[model samples]
Target: MNSLVLIAVGLLGILSGWFFYSRFIAARIYQLDAQFRTPAHEFRDGVDFVPTNRYVLWGHHFTSVAGAAPIVGPAIAVIWGWGPAFLWVVLGTIFFAGVHDMGALWASVRNRGQSIGGLSEKLLGSRARWMFMLIMFLVLLMVNAAFATVITNLLIQFPTAVIPVWGAIVVAIGIGQLLYRAQVGLLWPTIIGVGLLYGLILLGNAVPVALPAEIFGLSDRVVWVLLLFLYAGIASTLPVWMLLQPRDYINGIQLFVALGIIYAAALLSAPTVVVPFINDQVPAGTPPIAPLLFVTIACGAISGFHGLVSSGTSSKQLDRETDARLVGYGGAVGEGMLALAAIVCATAGFATLADWQAVYTNFGAGSVGAFVTGGANIVSQGLGIPAGLAATILTVTAALFAGTTMDTGVRLQRYVIQETGAITGIAALKNGTLATLLAIGFCLAIAFGAASDGTGGMVIWPLFGTSNQLLASLTLLMVTVILARLGRPVVFTLVPLVLVLTMAIYALLLQIGTFLGDQNWTLAIMALFILGAAIMVGISAVTALRQTGFSLLAHRHPAE
Candidate 1:
């Protein structure tokens, strides 16, 4: 089948979800109130709690939750065949991710902007909250430290991307000043910002910037790591309007433009999908497609991490309660679109099935590498751009994604720290500056302390997939409990909650065995411990759901 077939179907289904189903959920279920006061206004500190334009908030939430996962996940999941991955990315985003993300935003907005973890404490008990928060802290640590290395390596490999990638920071700051300080409309700033960013991309293509072998005796990679962390620390602490909002907003626009390039390329080129619809030929020890596909493609289809971004940052910036449908659910749809594009690039870029098989020797063989390689080829062929320049554009786009995710992760980690301090009664931890210091300090330690070369952040990378999905499941559980409390329909949240928890736990168990076989005690023990914590939280959820004001707790009745 042609790659355009997949793009056409995916777009149709995704748009239908946004237009028809999301409207239904908004009116009949979520009942979003346009006049309702949002926490962005209620707690407008301007630092973390500034009320934002819905378009800008959607951009922030979309890019923050995006990372490299949506691209990586679908690209890798093409091993099973593009069909299954395509279905999951499309259907899962609409039913599972869209609802979960929107519900988390709504629940948080309704509860005075408490985090999903904080909501867990009130509904599922303190123990559950502790478990929930621990998982999130580890996930954030994985993101911040690992992404610093990811961005550094990308800069080193694609020197042409460096200029545009760093140049975007200056452009975003100017946009922020125009939008907030000058009080101008978003239109001019968006157009000018995107134009300048792409111009940087063109200039970068002309004058590639390469770092020296060493900067003051430290390796170039180490210097980049330090610089990245330093920037994240300061930028994350700035007011939302100053940096985070505009930076992510522009990056989001750039990414959509990139996606549009790929989609148009697929439409024009009409490249044949080289991979099989279903790979009946077994690749030796490939894991069963059942639960593994779900975990493998978490972010593109559904993610627990989205819940963190939603409740942690997005809910705080929501200008109106009604905007949750657009920001929360719409952000997820944006991710789904990215994933669909990934599936197309991975499957159709190669000349034949044999070419794809050479790369897909195992379950995790193809990720960002496949996405970039395949995407550059398609872009070059369809747009008449040189291969090297096309590659640079895609590379810079991917690096920007990782950078924005790190920004959000650093800030979210700080939130986790402050929340932990309040719960533990540590006055110092509750202070914003202190907590941010602790957050950055811990990430730096993980990067430098654990390894001589500042690559220790990768040690915990293996656990990110399972732990993240489990956390998503728990967030759904939190939402389910909240819906129960409100005496509203529970089916929307409840079913996805059950499905994600099952798949994530099953995948976690599988990883434990793999870790044990590989003699990776560090991963094995950590996975086992996380599994135990998840079970406890699940039990807590069950109890919370059962004890709900009698009948509601028993799910409307014992015999229902």
Candidate 2:
């Protein structure tokens, strides 16, 4: 098929969804009101709670939630075929992800910008809320470990990305200080920051940074992982505006530019899809597309993780409650666009079928590797950039995505730990520094604890998808309950909730069977735990719904 046709269809679908579907959701389902005060204004503290421009907040939310999942997930799932992947990415983003994200943000904003874990207590009972926090703690540990490992491996794979990656951090810190401390306008400073980032990319391409093969008897990758954790530990504890907001804004701009180049290349080069529309060559014993495909393409399509970013960070920064649709739902559209770009690249960027198959032969690192290379190929072929330079550009872009997400994951995990501790009456765990250290330690242990092959994230990646979807299901379920309580039509959130919950449970069961058959007791046990937590939360939500039959419950306003 012509690449333009595929690109046009995907882009059109997403745009139309944003214009019509999302607007309907905002007006009818969410019923956002600008008259209400926002938590950012009510709790204006310069630290975590500060009102932010909608555009700037959108940048932070999008980048934090985008991470490498959208790129990696769709890249991997296309192995099933382009058609199924494309359908899920488009439809799922519209109905599932956008609604879930917008709903989560709405819930948080209405309740004093509380995190999802905090909102659960208000919407459901205390038992479900605590269970939600426990699940959040576990899921975020996996998130931090996986993203840290992924970034480390990317830097090692593309040494040129290291200097640019670290350089951007320094630039971000400088920009943050100037903006927050000096109270300078962001226009000129942002331009300079972005210019410096691109300039460093050029220099990094020339003089790449790479650690030696061994350090203190540890492999280079291991050493890099440790260094990454150290950086994350510090970054997560810092004030939000100082690093997280400015850094993610810069990264988001780079991603947009990258997307522009890749899409232009797809149009100019117009490489045809060598892989079939529907691939029947999936590995033996792999689960069918019904549930497995849904989980595999979680981030780009619909992710529970987006809710965490929405409630945990973005909610506190939003200037108005009505902006949730634009930031939360619109950000999901941006992600869907990225996913579509990946689909176009994966399906048509390669020159031949053999070349495509070689990269996509398996699911682990190769899925990520294929996207970097395929994207590079598109840019190089279309923009006439040298192959090496093109690869360096995309590689650096991927690293930035991973780095931003890893630290943010740790930061959110720290919040969950502190929240859990306070709820459970564990004083020590509520200490900020201690919570951060514990979060980082657990991430390091998991990342380093995998098989000797050191593909810990890859080993746990399948479970991560299932867990991620389960989280989304629970978040949507809460939204459904909230809507029911408010006496609004619950069909919008309820339908997606049912579909996602069924898919997640089905996928978990299949994973458990496979892990047991392969004698991988660890994954099997984790799967069981995820299933149990999910069931517990599900039961709680259903019971709450039954007891309160769509009656309006007294709600806490943002001013409270």
Candidate 3:
């Protein structure tokens, strides 16, 4: 396929979803009202549910939703061929993600910004509330662990990355304090932060840190992972206004800027799309089309994890129901654009298929980071910057991006564990600090296990996708139940509900089988989790069907 045509198709997919399906859902089914008082009004808490302008909410929503998952998933998916990867991204965003996000926001709005867990209980049953929380905790733990490894690996491989990475963190904290505590507006702080961060990058090249070949006789990977968690722990403990929100705003802008540069380069060069639409080179027994592609590219298309962000953080800040369309629907499209950029970078900039394959073989799992850094290098070359410096800057930026994701993942995991403990009446686990520590411990254990296995834990990628998708499926089911209760049209909710559940279950089964055969402790733990998820989904589906049937019957009979 021609590169330009492929790129156009990807953009068209995003636009179609944004304009057609998302708009329709926002206006017709959700019937979002600008006049209605949102949860931000009803709850009115300064922390979570403060009323904010749609623009500010957009910043929050974008940051919360955009993370390592979108980048990592697309990078891996492109290995199969950009065609299937791009197709899933486009179609999945339109039908699956748009629906999932809009539904979550709508449900949250109706329920006064109560989380998905609470909404599930109100709509599905008390059991679903517990199941949702449990699944969310496990998923967050895996997300934190996986991205923790990814970030640490990148940092270890490129020691110079620490300069800009730490600089960004420091600048973010300063900006956060200025904006929130010092009563300074966002304008000055952001401008100053960006400038300072760039300056730090230049200085970093002058005086780079040179560590011993090993730290404490441990591999560089191990040291990096420990430092990353330590950083996450501190970041998570800070007030949202002071660190989390400001860092997210900076990261969000950087993401867009990087994307613009990459896209401009692609269009100018108009590189050939060398990757095949369907590669016969794919190893046998790998289902090239349906199940594997669907699971592998989960985040770009329709991440269930987005549901957590939508309901957990973004929903609480929405100023009105109408804002849901912008935050929920628009956020998904933004992520789709990120995925598209990854595809373009992987395909368009490569000189040939041979070069692409060489990078994949040489860098191994690090090919995605290398590809992106190379893209940055190409842009730098085209713009007359030193390629080495440019690549180092880009690599550091990617590391920072991954770091932010890990921070949020850790916090989400803590919330999940604490909430689960509360619901389960586990007094020992109810302390927030204790729960947070346990959450971190769980993630560290997974990372250590994966590292020791020497497989680099690429096998865990599919499991992450499955867990994320299942979360989305469960969220959709909850949305359907809520709509049914609220007497809204169930057709929209029902269709996507079935689709996500089917995809999630198929993916889970594949994971369970793979894990069972592996028989390792990590895989075994994953298998047990998958089995529990399977049962929860089955039970939830049956209950939802029965509830829908009763609603239909009652409507027809005008119940006595």
Candidate 4:
């Protein structure tokens, strides 16, 4: 199929889901009442609980969750063929991911914007809360490790992206300072910020930055990783308005503009997908399509991590209950759009089927590189730009995507740790700086220590995906419980909950066996632990559902 045709159809399907199906859930199922005062109103503080513009909040939620995972997942999963990957991205986003995100946000908003971990104690008892938070902590660790490796590798691979990626952060800090400190109007300042960012991209191409052979006797890649984590520590430590929000909003705009250019180029060039619809030419030792694809494409379709962002930060800033549907569900659909663009670039970027096969035959950090190269090639071919500069732009885009997620993951992980410490009565762990240090330390250890190849991102991705989806399943269980307890119909949340729970368990079990066979003892043990936690959480969910009864006419609604 032609890339443009595929894109147009995918866009139509997503729009239909957003306008029709999502609207039905919001109005009839979720019953989002605009009259309800949100947490942002009740806890209106300028630090973490400020009331936000719905549009800017959506941008924040979307970019933070969208990350490089969506691109990397679909980029790799198309190994099964573009057909299955595209199918899951479209259907999963509308049915599973969208519902999960909306339900998570809704649960948090009604609970005074508590994290999902916080809700577990109130809804599922203290033990289940501990188990859920433990799983979340591990998942975020993997996220930080993976994204740090990803960002470092991208900078090393595309040296031109180095300047632009770093420059954007500096510019974002300035934007935040002007907006929050100087009281400048949003429009002109934002336009200037974006223009400067693009200008850096061009200037970076002209004078690409390359590291010397050694930086204080360490390899450049290692030094880059260290610098990245250091930046993450400082950036994630600041208040949300100082760094995360403004930076993500700018990156979100950059992503949207890049998407427009890519699709317009595809429409004009009409690139034929050299990769087949159903690829049968699987190389030796490649995992089967069933469970692998589900885990591989976690964020593009449905991600549990989105639950963390929704409940962790987004819910805390929600201005009205009705905006939950728009920000939560809409942010997920926006991620699906980004995933579709990735699939297009991955499947059509190569000149021939063999070229596509060569890159995708093995799964690793390089899959992201493939997407960047292919996307740059496609846009360059159609728009008549230099391939090198185009590649630099896409590389910087991917780095920014990964960088935002890394910063946010560290912050979220620290919060989870501190919350866990508070619940467990460990006063020392509750210190913010100490918690942040612990978060960064764990990530660095996993990224540099356990990864034999030093590309921790690829190795831990399967773990990340399984843990991420399992967390989503657990989050959905909580969402189902909240709905049941609220006297609302539970079908919308219940259905996806069951589906993700089943698939994630199946994948985790399969991964456990695979890791055992590969002699990857660490992952095997981790997978087994997550699976055990899931079983416990699942038992609790089933017990709660039976007690509450999944009826639309629930007579005993819990206190809101």
Provide the lDDT at 257 for model 2: 84
Candidate whose lDDT is highest: 1
Candidate 4's TM-score reads 0.96
Stretches off by above 4 angstroms in model 3 are 182-185, 205-207, 283-287, 360-367, 426-430, 449-462, 521-525, 549-560
Rank by lDDT, descending? 1, 4, 2, 3
Candidate 1 lDDT, 1-560, residue by residue in tens: 98888888899999899998898888867889999999999999988888999999999999999988898889988899888999999999899999989999999999999999998898888988899898889888988888888788789888999999999999999999999999999999999999999999999989999889888899888988998998999888899889899999999999999999998877778889999888887488889898889988988889988999999999999999999999999998999999998899899988788988898888788787788889888988888778788888888888999999999999999999999999999889998888889999999998998776778787777788889899999988888777776666778888888888899999999999999999999889989989988899989998887766433223343223
TM-score of each: 0.96, 0.95, 0.89, 0.96
Candidate 1's TM-score: 0.96
State, as a TM-score between 0 and 1, how close model 3 is to the true structure: 0.89
lDDT, candidate 4, 1-560, per-residue tens: 78888899899998788999999888877889999999988998776787776766787788889879899999988888899999999999899888899889988999888899899989888888888888988888888888888888888888999889999998888888887789887886689888999999999999889899687778888788889999999988887778888888889888888888888888878888988888888777777888778888988799999999999889988888899887989988989998998999998988888888777766542368778889988998899878998898888888998899887888899889889788879999999899999998888777777664345655666788778888998998898887887778777777777777777888888888889999999889889998898788778877887787668444455644
| lDDT at 103, model 2 | 94
| Candidate 4 accuracy as lDDT | 0.85
Clashes of 3: 0
Candidate 3 local lDDT, 1-560, one digit each (tens): 55667768888878888888887888766778899988888987565566765655665566666666677677766777777888888887788787888788778787877778767676667776777777787777777777777676666666666787778888887887787679887678867877887787777766676456587777666676777888887776555566667787777767776677666666665667777876556544545455667666766688777888777767777878898998888878878887777776676556678776665552124345745665664566455556667666666656766777776777667666766777779987777678778877887777776666222334465567777777887787777666565556667767766777787777667666666787756766865776585567558756775665534222232112
Better of 1 and 3 by TM-score: 1
Cα lDDT, all candidates: 0.89, 0.84, 0.71, 0.85
Over the stretch 255-366, how does candidate 2's per-residue lDDT look in tens digits? 8888888888888888788778998886554458888888888877899998898999899899988889889998899899989988887878788878787776655424
Q: Model 4 segments beyond 4 Å from truth?
A: 363-366, 451-459, 552-560
lDDT of 3 at 164: 79
